[model samples]
Target: MKFSVFTASTPEWSPEQAVAELAAQGWDGIEWRVVDQPASPDGRPGFWAGNLATVPLTGLEEEVPRLRALTEAAGLDVSGVGGYAPCKQHDDVERLLAATRALGASQVRIVVPALGHVAWGGRLPTGGDYPELFAQARDDFRWVADRAAEHGVKALVELHHTTLTSSASAAMRLLDGLDPEHVGVIHDLGNLQVEGFEDHLAAFQLLGPYLAHVHVKNGAWFRDEVQGDDPLATVGWHHEWTPVNQGMHSVVEYLRTLKGHGYDGWVTLEDFSTELPLAERTAFNLAYMRRAWEEAQ
Candidate 1:
């Protein structure tokens, strides 16, 4: 149960700068984003999306070693690779695997893309074309798991918004279809807040065994009757993205649950708050996480 910070939180800083900041904050490791997007590349568009079509595959082999050295010099381990794999194309899985290998990552985070008009934070759209969409994703994940094993990496599907596994029950169904040895789950507590804290815990209990990775964050929930909106949409959560101890989430309970389940993987902190300065927010979160780890022990 080591502490790591997802570099996405400091998108404005260069990887070298981000590592130095983390070292100052006493973080043990880093989870680097390896998606094939210019926004995440070495230069330009530091915190915003860049033209994805212009992304090049050349020089990746050379860049990886340099980045690895940079991280190691800062006394940080490359925990995992955060990636995206669209189910529409099988080749995307292969590309993700190659990137993971280059980055020397042991785990790869994948998202099941959203398709069609679906209610915000509601269950995946079903019926008609949905069956085909789900079938494709099922097979796509299976193929990804097999490919990931070949590269000595595990594929952990994120419990992301608007995906087939957006909820605990849905994620359980998806996990049941895949082999846990190759395919596992990354539980994002903030994403589950749409359903409420109790529901989030229930989902975690259900998916406990398959949990391979964890994202630490928090959110508040409410309902808006005027728009006849789903309860998930009325969430007025704001500072829910603050440091571990500052937010409403119970880090002590979360750590207890993880230990009870024998989960010894990286508990990476991902703060998506735009209000505070990035480095300050990350430093605060890192300090809070250390406190939580000490309390847990």
Candidate 2:
């Protein structure tokens, strides 16, 4: 299992700083966060806004070469491109794929629509029409597969919480007829703990050859409040990101399971917690993961 860092989690570092630090800290690759994020109100970098490590999508074509050169200079490979382009948007997907191919990266993330009551940018999720959303995602992915083949880049759908494809089986449903060579799935264990907790052995076995990549992180459930009255009343439960070693699921066992299954792919760290300083947290995750890998052996 090769180790990498998704720049989405390293919001404070610039692209150049990220490459140099990651290389010095012994990371194998970097997954560039490809998004056109809004500027922060106070002019400081945040995870989703004003992120310095991100590769802006507006002029990504012209920027790919410079990013590629930087990663190469730091002795890091481009593990993948982490984009927020929805799978249904062909133009956006194509734009990302073109840049990914030029950067010599094999895959780009094409997100599926949300499902639960959660919202994005103040817009409600598609909570009413499950069948419709699934059908549309399937159609969209078919087009994505065709376009990916043309570009020699594989399109990936991440199994995220509150999305149409959160679980392994659900992702498989959308990707049933599509060829794994052109399109694949990202097995994000952190997201699974929030919405789709599946047995590691079963989930991996189910994904089979379609599991092209993995995102390593950890999360746990928390109780925020308890509504009044009845014995079985609704309890406000939420999931929060935690340190890799302190989450509900065991990171060590997860890595062991992946190795046992012969998954020789990238395991990108995506810790979203804000407990430690940027550099310390980044280095800590790598060291923790390295120890886990060694202990498993």
Candidate 3:
């Protein structure tokens, strides 16, 4: 199996720094994020880090091959390109794909707009009319699939809370008639560590066939007193980021399940642990994953 690190995890590093550090740290591939050109608000906190591992949407006619050479010299692969390409929009996909190919990546991450109550890495507010949004998203996802095929790339729909593609069944539904080769689902365990989590066996049963890649991060839920202004309001537990071995999700079991289903694709570490330094955190994450893989076998 291949191991990778999402550029978001090392926001403090430039593209060259990320490649050099990760290559020395034992990462096999990079899940590249394209946001130097500001694709959308879907760009995460990492975007603020001027020292970020990213490919710009423009100037890829020259920059892509240079970046590719730099990464190759470090003995790493440009695994995938990640950006907030909402299914509702399409005015910028050609530029995004141009950068993706220039970076020598075959996959791209697609995020559907947040429709219902969300949480953690993104928004979580009161409910919206998810059913109505779902109706629109069906057509939107199909359009994305067609576009990915036209660009000679596969779109990996990332599962996030409160989106139409959050759950296994929902993800399967969004990708139903689309060719898995042209468009697929990313089984992101970190995103799934939420209040209403899905069953592992059941989720994989539905999603395994469509799984083009996977991303993992570990964190545990903790109770935080919400000193609410409303007397009628009730408090709840929220997820807090932690190192790899200290999370709610059973990554070893998750990996074993993937292995059982013949998934040898890239497994990326998206460390959101702000408590530790980036170098220490990345080293710990990679070591934990290697140990987990050995034990899984």
Candidate 4:
């Protein structure tokens, strides 16, 4: 399996710094975070806001040459473009794919609209009508698949919390008539802890040909204040991102199961834990993954 680092996890690095350091660290590729970010309030980089490593959506096509040259010069591949394009928006999806193709990347991430009461990673209002949203996403993805084929790129739907296609089964339901070569799924292990937890081996077996990429991170469910002492009390649970060795998801077992399925694809690191400094976390995660990958082999 090839290893890449998703730029969203490297908020402190500039694009130049990101490629240079990733190459020096022996990473095979870099998955750019594609989005237009607001400037940091305190002039400091952050994960979700004002991330310096992110590639802006504005003038994306024009920016492609610079991006491609940087990665190529650093002896790194553009594994993928982690864009936040909403699938329902044609212009957004087109803009992303055009840039992805120009950058010599084959895959780009697209968001599946939420189907119901949303809890995470979405700005959609609560109480969305499920059936209506499902039909909309299905129609949107069909259009995306066709466009992706035209651009010679694959559109990937990520298994994210609160989204319509948060699990492999749900992703397949939406992706069902779409060609797997043009449209595929990103299996995100950490997000599964927040919503869509499934047996790794079984999920891999189910994904089969549609498993185009993987996102590795770790998270655990934590309880809010206790409401009552009843055995069946409704306690609130929240997700906290953790390091690879510190969370509920097992990186070694996940890689073992993935390898067992004969998947030799890009495994992008997206560690969101803040337990250590940015550079330390990046190096440590890479070393840990190397050890885990060898163990899996």
Candidate 5:
């Protein structure tokens, strides 16, 4: 599989700088944010606990060509569009698809709404019971898939926390009902580790055929039981996000599995540590992932 970097971890750099750095680190491509401009110039949205949001749609018609030229100049591909679009919203889906087409991205990453309850106090609702959510998501995504197909794009549902597809089995169930040509799965190694290394591997095996993209991240389980008014809030408190080679997850095994399955896709680095400068940390993680990729090869 090829390697890429997501600009989410390095928001301070312009897209051009990010692409250049990633290419220098041996990345084949980049996943870029496609939301409207952030409320602040610094790129962090005040909402969502200081997390970055998608790039704004205004001027994207002009911006897309600019970004495409930038990546092409750097010998990198625009891997995909990374943005938050609640599939339930038709308008949001349309906007995202428009951005996807403009940016010349063949795929778009979307999140499933958060679901389930954590024993430590983090509780989320099961999306299965919320038929309307999936119904809306499916219908909207189908429409998106149709439009994307017209432009040679595919819409990928990310197997991330808080969505119906948080786990492998759950994610497969969702994919089984969709057309692989138009829709596929973005398998994340770190999210799979939430269930345990072996369990995550099992999930990967189960969904390997549908993996359209991959996220490489590492983390370790913490034994501390979080004490808080919200048990769900404590769920993340029990684990530590770490750089790719430093965590308990068997990244080597994961990459080996992908290679064994004849998976030739983008494996994007997504470690989210705030301890180091963003650009420096991205370079370090990219280097580490390259070593792992070489070893796996």
Candidate 6:
């Protein structure tokens, strides 16, 4: 078993500093977030202060190797590579597959769209043809899996809200006939904490064979009172990421559940909140997880 932090949590750090600090904080690996823009620009190290501007999808050929060396030198492993690219986008998926090899990462994460989830961007299905969307997504991801096989890296479909993979079973169906050797899934419970909660045990059991890694994060939803009166209000969800253990879900129990299920894979941290100071949050999350994992053992 191992622990890793998404570099999206350390945007302000130079690549060297990001790896150094994470290693020092006792993390075992890096889950690199490849993005087109900084989610937060005025970043003091926080979740929004993502480690962006590192590699343009067009330029991963050389940058990935250089970044890999920097991470390994700091005593870290490349747990996985994550990006916002859609599976239908062949070019983006190809660069990520190459980058996964260059960084020595065993897996790459692709966020499959969830229906009715606005945060997943335009690829989301708010309302329209249902079966058509599922069919399209399945075909596109199958192609992605086939392409990733050429590079010897597994492409994971992240369980996210507002996408075809809003639940584990739904995700399984999408990847039903594909080779698990090239494609898999991520149990991102945090994303589900909002509008897509799935039964943990059932989800894990079904996806266990194809599970590449599990994402650990926390979030909760609140009502938009301004829409109307308390009882009659149009309740729009106000979801936000929070530090582990303090959110809606019992994260400690979640970790214990994964351990109990015989999953000895990667436990990736993604505290997507930008509230606490960098070291404090990083240190706290690391310490919290260590304790939970120890207790789980």
lDDT of 3: 0.76
Preferred candidate (lDDT higher): 3 or 4: 4
lDDT of 4 by residue, 1-297 (tens): 789999999999999999999898899999999988778888888898889999999888888999999999999999999999889879999999888899999999998887577654436564668788888899999999999999999999999877888789999898988999999999999989888878888888887888999999998889888766788878888889998889987899999989888999999999999999888888888899999999996
The estimated TM-scores of all candidates read 0.79, 0.95, 0.86, 0.94, 0.80, 0.89
Candidate with best TM-score: 2
Per-residue lDDT of 105-196 in model 1, one digit per residue for the tens?
A: 77877767564456432336443365566667787877887888887777887877666776667666766757677778888877666431
Which residue runs of candidate 6 sit more than 4 Å off their true CA positions?
38-54, 114-119, 122-128, 223-237
lDDT of each: 0.68, 0.90, 0.76, 0.90, 0.68, 0.78
Off by over 4 Å in 1: 36-62, 118-129, 195-205, 222-243
Report the alpha-carbon TM-score of model 5 versus the true structure.
0.80
Clashes of 4: 0
Clashes within 3 Å, all models in order: 0, 0, 1, 0, 14, 9
Query: How far off is model 5, as Cα RMSD?
Result: 5.1
Candidate 1, residue 162: how far the Cα is off, in Å: 1.3
Q: Give lDDT tens digits, candidate 3, residues 1-297.
A: 889998877877888888899999988988877654433355543533442566665554567778888889999997788866566757556566666666778888876767656552344553667887787878877887787888888888887766677777788877887888788888888888853258766777777568888889878889878785887878788887777777887889988877777788889888888878888888888888998888886
- In the range 38-144, model 6's lDDT, one tens digit per residue, is 44455533343345424455566768778888888999988899777777777888888888887899899875655642544533345645587788888898889
Candidate 2 lDDT, 24-80, residue by residue in tens: 999999999998888987898988888899989998888999999999999999999
What's the CA RMSD for each of the models? 5.5, 1.9, 4.0, 2.0, 5.1, 2.8
